[model samples]
Target: MLLSSFVRKGLLFFLLTCLSIHISKAQFLLNDSISYQPKKLTTLGISAGAVYGVSMFALNEAWYKENKREEFHFFNDAAEWKQVDKAGHFYTAFYLSALSAQSINQCGVKAKKSALLGSLAGFVLISSIEIFDGYSEAYGASVSDLIANAGGSVFYWWQQNHWQELRLQPKFSFHRTPFAPLRPAVLGENIPTEILKDYNGQTYWLSADMDKFMRFPKWLNLAVGYGAHSMLYARDATNTANGYDPYRQYYLSVDFDLTAIETDSKFVRGLIKALSVIKLPAPALEMSKKGVKFHPLYF
Candidate 1:
C-alpha cells in the first residue's frame, strides 16, 4: 500500500535533470554561446517517454504484482494520515511539473509549450500510478490522489505562466521514529524501509517565500507542514487494540530557500537547487490532538 519510494525516485530523477539543465545553461550563458536544436528536443522527449515506460513496467512487476488482484474500483483515502499522503502526492506533482517544465525549456522548447507539456506529463505520471493501485487488492485508485495531483500540477503551471517563478515550494522532511519498531511488518523491517513506509516519520510541507508578498529576506520562508504519529494500522481501532493512539501533527516553521542564496558558481547553484527540495531544520510550533508543543529543531 505504500508507494512513496516510487514517487520519490521519480521526483528525484526530475530534480536532477532540472539541476543539470540549469548548470549547463548557466555555462552556456557565461560563454555567450547558446543554441537550441529541434533534434535535441525530440531526443529528450523520446528519452523521457522511454524512462516513464520502463519505470511503470518495473514498478508494476516489482511492487504491484506482489499484491492480490482486485476489481477495478475507486477508493476514498482523503482522510488517511490526516491527508499526509495527499500532501505528498501534491508535493510530487508540483515539483515534477516544475522540473519537467524547466527541463523542456532548456531543450529550446517555447515557454508556453514546455509549461503545458510539463504540467500534463506530471499529472499523467502520478495519475498512472493510480491505475496500478486500482488493480491491486491492497489499494485502489483514489480520487483524492488525483485531485491532489491536479492541484499540484495546476499550481506549478499557473505560477510559471503568471509569476514566472516559484514563490511557494512544496518540500519534504523526515525524522527517524521509534514507532516503526512497534510494527515492523506494517511499518518496515529496517530503518531505510521504515523511512519510506512509516507515515509517522514523514512530513510534507509548503514553504512560501514571504518576500513575494512583503518586504522580507528572499531566502527566508514561512512553512506549514503536516505529519502523523502512532499509525501502525489504517484503522484507529486496530491501532488502539495494539495500545497505540493515532494523532495528526501540524507544524508552523521557518525554512530557507537554498536556491535564493546568491551564487555565481553554476555547480553551487545546481547543488542549491537540488537541496531546495528539503525542508531545512528550524524551530517549529506543533499543534496536534495532544495540544501545542514547541521544538527547538524540527526537520
Candidate 2:
C-alpha cells in the first residue's frame, strides 16, 4: 500500500508541478497574489489545495511512517479508485486546475468581464493539464474525469441560475462524527453565535456543487464550506506550549464518500469510513507530529 500510495502521490505531485508550468503559460507568470475572498476563484483554489492537503494528512497521518504500511488507506481516499484511478485523477486535476485558472481570472487584473471568464480560463487550463497527463506512463487519459470536470463547472454555473433552497438541500453538513453534533462548524453565518467564535457562536456552511462532487455513494464527504478559515489555533501566543505552539493548523477538508452505498456495502464501507472518521480533531494538527505541511501546486 505504501508503494502504491507513494506512486500515486508522486504522480499527483508530478502532475501538479507540470500544472504549475501550464499556469505560467496562461498568465505568462503570476501577476500578484490575492487575499482569500468568498468565491474569488483564486481563494477557492487555495481552499481546494487546503482540502487536498488536510484530507491527505487526516486520512493517513504518517504516510511514509516508521516502516512502511502494507496499505495507505483513508475513507476519503478520493473519487479516483472507485472510478478508476486514471480518469479519477484526471477529473480532480482538471477541476483543481480550472480552480486555479478561475482564481487567476478572478483576480482584479481582468476588465469588466464577468467572473465566468475566469472560470472558463480555469477550465481550459485544466483541460491542457489533462492532455499533458495523458502522455505520461504513471497516468493516462480518462473520459470519466473529463465528464466530472465538466460536471463540476456546470454544477457551479447552475448554482448561479436559481440557487433555490428548494432545488437543493438548504444547507448540508460538511463534517460530522459519531462523537458530536451533525453540522458544519459555524460561528457566524446562517446559525447565530451563542458564544463568540470561541465556544458558542454557530454558523452555517455554504453548500455548493463541490460539496457533492467530493462525496461517493457509500461514504460521507465533508467540505471546507468556508472559502477560507484559519485552522484552529490557541490564542495564547506568548507562552508557547513548551516552546512549541500547541496550536495545530487545522485546514478544513471536505469528506467524499457515499451514504447510499455505505448503507448497502455495510462491511466494506464501514471499514473505510472508520479510517476517515478520526483526523485533525480540533487539535493543533499543523503542529502535530501527524501534520502534513506542503505547498500546493501553485502556478
- Each candidate: what lDDT? 0.75, 0.33
lDDT of 1: 0.75
**C-alpha TM-score for every candidate:** 0.86, 0.28
> lDDT tens digits, residues 43-124, model 2?
5457555644554444334432233323222232233222223223333333344334434544444321322443454345
- After superposing candidate 2 on the true structure, give the runs of residues whose Cα lies further than 4 Å from its correct spot: 1-80, 84-113, 137-139, 161-299
Reference-based TM-score, model 1: 0.86
lDDT tens per residue, model 1, 1-299: 55544344444455436434533432111111235668877877787777777777777777777788978988787766657777877887886777677667777777766777788888887788788778878778899989999999998888777766667788889998887788777667787767667788889888898998899987789999999888877667777898889998999999987756677886786677667888989999999999999999998
